[model samples]
Target: MASGKKRGKKPEVEFRNTQLADALQTQDMAAVAFALRHGPTVVPLMRPGARDDPRDTGEVWTFRDPKTGQVALLLFSDALHKPEAMPKAVGLHSPEWLRAFLEVHGDEITTVFFDIAGPHPMQASPADLIAALDA
Candidate 1:
């Protein structure tokens, strides 16, 4: 689940900060539960009290969001550099953050799921994620 796999027949869209927000929130369950709903699967990466280093928070995480029917993958972490420190350490990309981010920057994201990886970006649909998981 770590890898961003292609799902469904429509396409997988690259959800930006904005769109992700709605998926996380706009529901009845608590923030945590909501995020879990969108997330296809939980990939435990870090753990609690594993090391001594301050940077190492013993936190764990699964791969990227699978965009399952319950909920889309809403990412949250602490290591906030300037904009977004990619390919770096991982943390709790909580559902609350996902909703907030999407509410603020939903327009910036590009949709590409309907098509190939390049050319245009699409807002990955629920069905698309399911298909990708099956694939």
Candidate 2:
């Protein structure tokens, strides 16, 4: 008998640094919209060296994925050269920031497109969050 769930599926990709740069360089309008239609996702994560405690985490640093429960990355930059250029951690209301951010990552995000902010866009379960974030 076959298993209830499908098997022989290719394993998911998570934290594949090499592939990241590619996603950022190939974004388009339709792709971005597809992400919005699905739902807002991802949360900015703080730079480990920058934050002391979790509360101190910056707003513009990471994105938490709802389906995968993984906190992808969102680096906010101010000067691009200056060390402090990292964007200040932004909460949900920063529409301008969100737009700019998506532009910056226009090449690296192959699977998920569009940048997200605020709290987890939905009340994501741990497993679901992991799946999406990890994907």
lDDT (CA) per prediction: 0.33, 0.34
Q: lDDT by residue for model 1 over 28-120, one digit each (tens)?
A: 224323333344221123454345665543443322334742332323311221123233444433444334433444344322121112122
2-61 per-residue lDDT for model 2 (tens digits): 679866888742321212222323543333333332333333334332435644424455
Please give the lDDT score at residue 110 for candidate 2: 30
Lowest-sum lDDT 10-residue window in model 2: 75-84
Per-residue error for 120 in candidate 2, Å, reads: 11
lDDT for model 2: 0.34
lDDT, candidate 1, at 39? 45
